[model samples]
Target: MTTDRADDRNVAVVTPWYPNPQQEWAGAFVQAMVEATAPGCDEVTVYHNEAWLMRQAPEEVEAAREAHRRLLPVALHDAPTVAGARLMRLPVPTVPDYTFAELAQQHASWLRESLGGEPIPARVVHAHVGLRGGWTALENARPDARVFVTEHASFIDKVLEQPDSRDMYEQVLDRCTGFFAVTDVLRDRLAETFPALAHKIELISNPISFEAPRPRPVTELRRWLYVGTLVERKGVGWLLEAFAECHAGDPELTLTIAGPGVLAGALAKRAAELHVDHVVTFTGEVAPDEATRLMREHDLLVHPARWETFGVSIIEAVAAGMPVLVTRCGGPERTLAGIEDAVGEMIDVEENSESIVAGYHRLRDRFPDGLDLAKGRRVLDERFGYRTVAQAHYRHWFSGPEAGEGAASGGEEA
Candidate 1:
């Protein structure tokens, strides 16, 4: 990265969750945007506030606080580099279930920490997610600098349910320069709930580019794959029953459930009870790179997620040209609408066992020889690849007054 191209196009990206050594996969896509845009823009400063304390048990809070006290960066030398971007960890705010005002105050302190009493030279302060990060950007962004937010939280449904959070979120939207959404479904959902801010909302989906490292082999197992956590909401239990339904049709078929969660033991037990234990393999929490490789190595991706804002794994598989089976979990339908069915498929999330089993049968019957995944890679890259999305984001960042021209007015589900 020559500083020449980015002369003064400094951007400060703030997020409440980011990937760290302890939580390797947390908010990784946000880091991807930071790295890709850094070369095109002058400089990128990431102020990441890891709020893992909220997930800790009540008795473990003090111990977890001590661990973070040892980890949070208070100076630039101690700042870490992730995916070619400089990252500084800010102290986490108080849990918002109790109070939103205190959360905003903590974020105000974090913005001051970024400046060290100096004026920020950022051309734009972009925040990912809502509330605290959004509040920080809204308060500290230079008057001339732009304030943009890219929201990806699934908890927006709950946020809307609360009077205080909903009102605060509306205030956050009203004051910001622009808002970005990952999926059209979410963009529509936001527009529906906050009609006043609907015109300010825009669509800029997440980035994904697959580079095959090795020649992936075609195995004879006729495998069915699931890449998300083994959680109840993810419907991994439904996946087991669905796979069991498919297993009876083809004895040669096998299932691989990657990624770990609290339901791992129960899922394994259910597989045994289905008498398909010998056919099911449990891979606890595969890393992103390894997960990408697994997508190519396997015959198909069976995603039975009950809920998703946007399914990254689906694009990953489709980008690799692998066949996919997804459920209508808010975003999958919109995602698959762009891809060819020979390369992917979807089922009704409500009728999981029957629909997924039928979906598998459809994959087997239709793609008897499996899909030519590499065939669709070029098109997928042109649309959702990192470089393309980053360039689009860069244009929006620097567009200034012209930015809101194409912003969605009716919040069309585009």
Candidate 2:
């Protein structure tokens, strides 16, 4: 994957969020995008600018910084290469008090220092997340490089709340050669914040693979699965309660909660208190491939999320031939647009268990006869399959005579 000559067609990916030992699900979408687009490029390298938060006593702050300075020199090449792309994880250590703009600046500083203050070698750079990766890439990429940014942050509202961060975000949009959002929800949010730059943001989907369908379309909906962080905002608490109610009615029912989060311990304890711990399995932080495997092993995807920018997991579940019982959260509403009934049931977002319970019942009642899993799969694959998204990237990244300079004419599909 290494080459002596830096081809003008080489691509560099920069991002603050990436799958790591501490958080395996952190940036799986970015990884998927890289995996999709790498084959067409002469070279691809991922610079995972991991912003590691530091909590230290005031007296030991300087010592912690010194330790980080020593550790970072050797840590750059420690990440495992993914999808034939060379991986470099540059850990940017910082105190917890920095604002979003400041944190982004810190990532840029670490990236610059790691590269010995040199520009990224690639002529084209694709960055995930508008603030951290986008800003960092803009600051560190070669002057002639065309930097494209994709916005997928769930807490974009919070980021825009701070004036400094919002101003910096505007600069990112203004400077980047192209900008995309994974869903209309995120695109509209950014557009609303900066009405003048609305024309710059366009819709692009995260790629999903449908090469391996489930062994068989699920005949029954007894096996329930939830793949996401176990946190209140994700509606995991409500999922547990709803699962308990469902299990009580059907003793054979089972639930598997995958991925890690702050509420893991509490959720397990609550499951025990509900007396359904026997059937509940908590798989903490599975790798992306394992998460896909889990989708195949189960019959249903129960995503009780309060919000999502794109709902990649839901789309993945459908790709794996599993019916989804998801909420009408921001992203799912758009992602599952016309194919809602064919794929699964969509419940209104709520804090209690009632909506999920009702949705599950509705999905079970519809089962095999009332759904067209094949049709749903076909529609989603046409929009988000690896080949489709990869080609879109190529058209945008290498369209013009100079390559990556034809951002204005990039595909404008919704």
Candidate 3:
């Protein structure tokens, strides 16, 4: 299952977020994108830039450096094989003296140096997010190389919040050979923010790595699920209030919040104060299989992110034929675009508590009744499945050097 062509499709994928033993689901989507790319190329090598001390606990930081001072590169070449790709994990020791761009350059150069100081002669360097990885790829790009950047990071939401950040981000974006956005709305937002590159910004949805699992029957007690890090922007507190609203009317309702984060204890305590703690369960970060099982068993998924570029979890839920209630906080609204009939209504973040409560009630009313979750899944596959996303990347990968660019979608449906 290897390519017959000479290794022309060789690509170097560099990213800040990548799955490691310590962080299993940190950049699972980026890995899925790489896997989707595997079959087409001669060989795809991934360089995960894990900046040490950059985000580590203070105590763990000193201990980690003492233990792994060598910081050597290792080949983790198999197991989760992607037809034609090789996995290389490099653990980097962070130097606080470097700025984001400087650190990123060091990361990319280190990878290039690892290959015996040979300038990587890959077709392109694809960086998963815009933060530093995208800028790094641009800086390290060979004179003739094509550099593709995908800005699916939610930081863009925050970037837009501040004047200086927006300028700094766009300065990095200007260097990309091409830019990919996770949703059409996001593409539009990027274009609106930086009209100069609007034509080059293209719509590229996040790929769903898993197939639709066989869904379970709707439980008699009506199980509700929420899968993601429980953080402030996730609107877990708002969800607790809304959940209590629903439960006050129907004692049979149960809400299970999965995934762990800084907000877990607080959310649980809030749930207790709301008197729904008896019914609410907080199961800290389960494995993927357990997550899929939970998605299958539950009838509804409540996702109320204050901001999101795109919600891959919604795609997973739709695959399991589970209904979801989301907020139009950002990009998740795009998930509802073509599948509104099946997905029903999405809540407006500006809405009051009663309105949020009402949206949940509305989603429950439509669940399993007239809702064909499979129809939503069909729409998801057509738009966000691996094949669709990979093909989009393939086109970008092979685009002639003269194709030039604008911040744009390739005029394809997002």
Candidate 4:
């Protein structure tokens, strides 16, 4: 972290979510951003601040905190740096159910403790979420460092509704050098939430890397894939019902549910209840690379999430050269705006499977001729490809020296 390095090439990423042994699917886009932006920079370090909540009784909380304070030093001594960046895993032990503002304070305090009360030794710091990550960066970043935050949490509405959390978020918005949202839906939500700070927010899409040509183009839409957490919010139940209906007509049709969540067993039982368990496969959580491979093997990606701030999986599927049948959740509508007909179908979000079944039929009728997978892939690549996203980040972070130095006074135009 020497100043002799190229200007604005030394960057630090502070994030509450990251791929770890406990949750491999968490904060994958944050890792992608680090990997994509790291190549162009001289150095990148990621400080992953994760909470290790204690389930002990109220009377034992103090003892647990003391034990954690003693054990953390030994734990961090042999921590490994993974992937393309120098990773520092900062695990904070605490009780669960704290409000967002209180939780952010704990996260920031842990980061400062890890650094021995010293400021983060980087010129630019980018955090994944506003509350804990952005607030952590703002608290620890050097006086001259340019700090930025990207809002990507699906539970952001809950976080902002609380008075304490909203006040803390406003402070974070006021202090950071710049802020970005992954999609127009998220940007609009943030803008409307704080109209005075609306001008400071902008768009920065998640990056995707295109793979080699598929061995063969999809001639038929038989194999369906869903790659995400198996949660109620993801509409996994609706997806399962729709799959059963589709499979009844076409016995050859199959569905694969990837990723892990609390609803795995319930979804499995529901599949059996629908009598489609034999045709469905549940492969629990997978590494990011394996998720990509799954996309390559399947003909279509079916993401039936009730909502999304930014649907990274939908873009990843398209990059893998697979068409998608996703819900018109907030993200997919904006991400697939003009290319709806070219990619696949965009059905409305619903509790029942009727929309999904009808959309599947409509997409099936279009088949190979009516759809243009290549055009969809090209369009998304130009927008979300690694090169495109990394450059956009650099332009905002290092376009001028004034931007880096004016953190307290509000930096140069983004």
Per-candidate TM equals 0.84, 0.94, 0.83, 0.94
The Cα local distance difference test for each model comes to 0.72, 0.88, 0.73, 0.86
Name the best candidate (by lDDT).
2
**Whose lDDT is higher: candidate 1's or candidate 4's?**
4
* Backbone N/Cα/C clashes per model: 4, 0, 12, 0
Model 4, residue pairs in steric clash: none
Q: In model 3, where do residues sit more than 4 Å from their true spots?
A: 1-5, 54-70, 73-84, 95-106, 109-116, 157-168, 217-221, 401-414
In model 4, where do residues sit more than 4 Å from their true spots?
1-7, 77-83, 403-414
Instruction: Rank candidates by lDDT, best first.
Output: 2, 4, 3, 1
lDDT per residue (tens digit) for residues 6-72 in model 1: 3235688988877676666677678777766776655678888655336667787768756644554
**Model 2 steric clash pairs:** none
Model 4, 221-335: lDDT tens digits are 9999999998889998899999999999999999999989999999999999989899899999998988988888899899889998878889998888888999988999998
Ranking by TM-score: 4, 2, 1, 3
lDDT of residue 151 for candidate 2:
90
Provide the lDDT at 63 for model 1.
83
What does the lDDT read for residue 304 in candidate 2? 88
Q: What would you estimate as the lDDT of candidate 2?
A: 0.88
Residue 115 of model 2 has an lDDT of 92
Model 1: weakest 10-residue lDDT segment is 405-414
lDDT of 2 by residue, 209-254 (tens): 8988989768899989999887778999999999999998999999
